[model samples]
Target: MVVLKKKEMMQCYTFFLLIIVVVASAIPTKADDQKKRVKEKSLSDASHSEDGEHNNDYDHEAFLGKEERQTFDQLSPEESRDRLGKIFEKIDKNSDGFVSEDELKDWIQYVQKRYITTDTERMWKDYDISDTNEITWNAYMKRTYGYGDAGEPKEGDPVYEYRDMITRDKRRWERADGNNDDKLNKEEFSNFLHPEDAEHMREIVVLETLEDIDKDKDGFISVEEYIGDMLSDQKKGEPEPDWVVNERKQFTDYRDKNKDGKMDKHEVMDWIIPTDYDHSSAESKHLIYESDKDKDGRLTKQEILDKHDLFVGSQATDFGEALTRHDEF
Candidate 1:
């Protein structure tokens, strides 16, 4: 009788354990469903659509929509070419007209000046591959565009066709880097500059990016106009004047290892690379890619210093706030 009772107790314990496990497993699924529902609702709110009709806005454009094309018009010819080359190469990974995000990972890294200002920092945050912890090319493009098909509203549109010239220049840049060191030399910069065909291709991409952001039928992107459109969350009453208030908390957290209000741009850039400063000549720790400077196989401290002004210029969109926040960053 004692043995039989012990066996019955064991069975009951096993039954209870099974019930607990089943309940635990179900909670996550339920939570996930709720989270998805919430996300869907948020999208609907952002697009001002009912029944999630607005999600289709992303469907028509590969990277930017009609609303986004206007922003790139202000870029100079060089900036336009570099930026557009990246966009074209993003979608044409195989150097083919069509591509998926997976293939673009092997594409060569494009080196521009390191960002010392907030605008470039923001752009890098949105587009830079290493910072986002995503390795694939599609992920990089998606990070920049936030949607697909800037030219077409749906798949199979000729507007979805990728540019051939941009893809070639991107490939050429990658090929020139040879050793795959992230930075390029004076020779590499010259190669990109001297390419007669690259100029035309850059214009196409730069114009496209500008058109993506250039709203209000204006030829140029004024600070007020650019900031109003990019930063405004129509859902959240009036646009945010600057990103400072929004990122104020996070920036504060990262500021002042030395307890000063200022963050040294180089120090901040280094921190963005690997953990703490690892300045030993080890290849792994070097984060800044100085691809365009003199042929020394390295970017100088002065080059790193210029990033500050670019970032500041990009971020300080309003004159009043620009003046106030000039020294703050």
Candidate 2:
């Protein structure tokens, strides 16, 4: 029961979960192509429905990231539209009458950056107890894994996963330590937390990916291992779904380039780090695709104002605020 309770708490606070290894894998078995496909349709950077309905909350998040979305949610419909109109002008980037793709993409990136800043500050307070403007490796480990009477699980304990997670966090933390001092200042801590957002930390992201899906400990991914990762969620007695079967074919036909029958390091890199998928660009294109009237391929101020409800007009979309009011684990 205690283990189950910890698992539940971990899921809720999993945004900074690279350290919580057992609770979350740093990468997916594969980047969820289904969600990626759905993202292209709705303005969602995450997942959505097949029919591409106007997912208001998702669009809001894609345009303004998680934290900003919560802030926007506080606005009344009239106030929301007025504020969105001001934001749209800034997104236009030039004095041009329309918002070009580049302009929209840049704005989305800015919104995401703002969210990352807030997230880093919020989490920084938890680890930087000494207020020395740095989060030491020992400080982080002590705060996260904990100490004293069985606070941390031991080698043979039922929750032994923490041991492996501690090792993994140390590797990542070291990589983020650009100064080589074994301590992460504020900037380094952000890189440590969200490596995906940092260009330099791409290798760490890939290393974590390989460590995650390369489960055979043989240093490569076989087609069976690739398929098996997906089946982690499959029920005990159920037959493999058609999509699962199709994925097996995808591995041989598309994923396993060079006809090697197994994914080498480069192959795994190519598979996960797709070149074409840009979350900001995808959301921008989809937003323009749906809301752009007169088929102009770009949004005019009035066109966006007309579709204000589709963007920030979400009310019941409040996420986890009430839940967060409780004492976190």
Candidate 3:
């Protein structure tokens, strides 16, 4: 048995306490680190809460008119086949069995025009309440945000149905108002709605898109940030979901073209907008690829009907709407 005097025991206790303090100071507490991360995320989210508009890289619903969207959804596969056959007939203006590259290009242009015209008319009716063929800032705010006579939204008033839209449109209004007149003519309004149509406006759209996804404010998107934006509901400190894991792999493999472990502006733009190709042309090429059974460069009516499933689903045959509808797209 060993026994120590009081003074000796007191000195030993002090030495033990010093060692405990040193170790405690060396390691960071998990809870503190988590709290700090949460605080940073909260501040970042608050700063960009109003800037919630996102370009749907994979869908086209924004381009479709309401009636067209509904009508397309209601189509059966057989009806889709008939409708597509008619559309092909229209494109095959010469009554030839096959559609040429020029004819396909023209049809693609017409489809683009149809979407723009429909969406423009709908937005015009909503914002141009005075039928003056222009939208003032006041008109835009009142219609979009549901502001009262005082020119501000009431404190207890219900949030606008499209609150994010109000923020996005306001920003666009400022940008599209080239003369800084605080008003938008029909042409300016069209540019705001479809910035991709205006070559100059495309840059703004690309920048905004990048900012929306770049969570850390580092001017680039890491694999984790890319997955986080794509899967917003994913919780911190939880096991990464399969989709997130797969997307991380994809980011490294494809999106991070420079192999830099992060995606820069050019890479992000390529992922989102895909350079050297228009959506309409892409859709046209997809259709031709699916239906051109004889390996010809063009599609024949018989070939399209034979592979009608590729054109129209059994639940909804109106695949044309898929060209502009995000879900089907």
TM-score on alpha carbons, each prediction: 0.20, 0.70, 0.64
lDDT of 1 by residue, 1-329 (tens): 00111111121111100000111211122222111111110101122221323222211111222222233435543454344344444435455543222322221111111111222234334433554332233332233223333232244533223333223324444554435653334443333322211322233223322333346545443334333333444456665434324334333444234544433433332222223422112211121232224444433334323432221122222101212222312
Compared to the true structure, candidate 3 yields what TM-score?
Answer: 0.64
* Clash counts for all predictions: 33, 0, 0
- Quote model 2's TM-score: 0.70
lDDT computed for candidate 1? 0.28
Clashing pairs in 3: none
Locate the minimum summed-lDDT window of 10 residues in model 3.
13-22
Work out how many backbone clashes candidate 1 has: 33
Residue 22's lDDT within candidate 3 is 10
> What is the full ranking by lDDT, best candidate first?
2, 3, 1
For candidate 2, the lDDT comes to 0.58
Model 3 alpha-carbon drift over 4 Å, by segment: 1-78, 148-168, 234-246, 257-259, 316-329
TM-score between candidate 1 and the true structure: 0.20
lDDT pick, better of 1 and 2:
2
